[model samples]
Target: MSSPEQRAAAILASQRFVVIGTTDADGPWTAAAQYRLRPRGLYVESDLGSRHARAIAVSGTASGVVYDSSAAVADADGVQLAFSAREVDATEPAVRAILASRLPRDAGPVAELDDEVAAVLAVPTKRLYVLEVERAYVFDRDAWRSRGTDARIEIEAADVWAALGRP
Candidate 1:
């Protein structure tokens, strides 16, 4: 049987997008965005003026889930994460690395990558956001079976990263 960390890694690796939950004075909101996973957490790109981004700016925190929508209820699995979110400068090396990784091999040479990153950064409204996960959880099937109730088990972020083959 796979460990919780392995299960979480599989779920995260199989998904391209995460549904992020946030809130403001108005109330709670959720939005789905494409993500790039990193050892520390994940990165998402969005407009700085977006509701989610604005909420993150105010609260500095968010929670999200990544799961397979097509899975049967009995076979369902996913990773739930609580995060400290912040807007990261696009010029930062890690941000640039994320941008570069998004480029296709056929896209062009190094110069083109530079141009692409520059163009993206040129847009004042667009920003790169980092969600530094504070806590992570996965469904505890053993507990569910034993207790006849659904539950989640917390796992270390490092374990998830290791399972995903990251340092």
Candidate 2:
């Protein structure tokens, strides 16, 4: 049996991005953005001009979801964990390097040309939130509930780095 930590790590390890949910005076907004899981928290790069970036700057609240699709349970019942956090600008060289490392290769040369991507680089924020896992449920049609828990998981940055086998 997979320990909760291992299972959680697997969920994160398998995914490179998360749907960042933000709120404004109007209502809530959700968008899927690429993220780099680091020894500290989750890192995301966005254009300073994008709606999401503006939202993060004005309000630090955000949410993310990670799940296990390989479970024996039904497809709809895959184990999923949703979380929330506070945003921190990943402006420093060290943090940028960490975030860069987590980026999917398919991200292309978007960050390669320093001049063209300057707007995004300026706001490369690492989201540092309380990471409240709102829920964890199996999506399987029949055996879903038997496979998961609605437990609050405390995942530190070190743990993420450990799972990645990074120092």
Candidate 3:
């Protein structure tokens, strides 16, 4: 059994990836986009006025998937993780600057946002679901842990919200 600190480290160390889920008017929407893991959260880039930017504005909720396929390539054990997150717009100059420093230049300039484009995507995690693989056997973390999923050490939505201090 892993300790709480180990579990936390596991989550923190996992490389982030992207998945596309869809929304109609103002909820979860779909699109396959590339993203990377950062210490703060998941970071993705898109232009303003794009479907993703608009959907995030309308719904404020989104989901992403990250897989540890390294194991597949390395012939080692691995896990796939899914994240439910809320998107925060990096529209403010300061936020844009912070994102700019972390993201590539082609993503869009921090200062030169076209009237129609959004700058950056700030995805704060709310929930995480992980699937573990052992010797080609796949199982949910709960099953691997011999307990309910809730029994695993994870940050609750309230804890994430408090840490972000966002409304």
- For this target, which candidate reaches the highest lDDT against the unseen true structure? 1
Clashing pairs in 3: 21-29, 21-30, 22-28, 22-29, 22-30, 23-28, 23-29, 48-117, 48-118
Q: Each model's number of backbone clashes?
A: 0, 8, 9
lDDT, candidate 1, 1-167, per-residue tens: 88889899888887889999999999999999998777558878899889999999999999999989998877778899999999877565755776654313113477777676777788878888888889999987777667767889999988887777764
Candidate 3, residues 1-167: lDDT per residue as tens digits? 75333433343345444454537565556665655433334556555556765565555545544345555433222222334344443445545443443323124554564421332323332211111111111224554445433222233332222232321
Q: What is the TM-score of each candidate against the true structure?
A: 0.84, 0.56, 0.43
lDDT string, candidate 2, 30-144, tens digits: 8777665554345665555666666666775566665544556443322344454444444455434443444233234645645424544554442322233444432333333
Total clashing pairs in model 3 = 9
Name the runs in model 1 displaced over 4 angstroms.
Answer: 90-94, 97-112, 143-148
Ten contiguous residues minimizing lDDT sum, candidate 1: 99-108
Superposed on all Cα atoms, the candidates' RMSDs to the truth, in angstroms, are 3.4, 6.3, 10.3
lDDT of each: 0.82, 0.51, 0.40
Error (Å) of candidate 1 at residue 12 is 0.7
Off by over 4 Å in 2: 68-143, 146-161
Error of model 3, residue 50, in angstroms: 3.4
Which candidate tops TM-score? 1
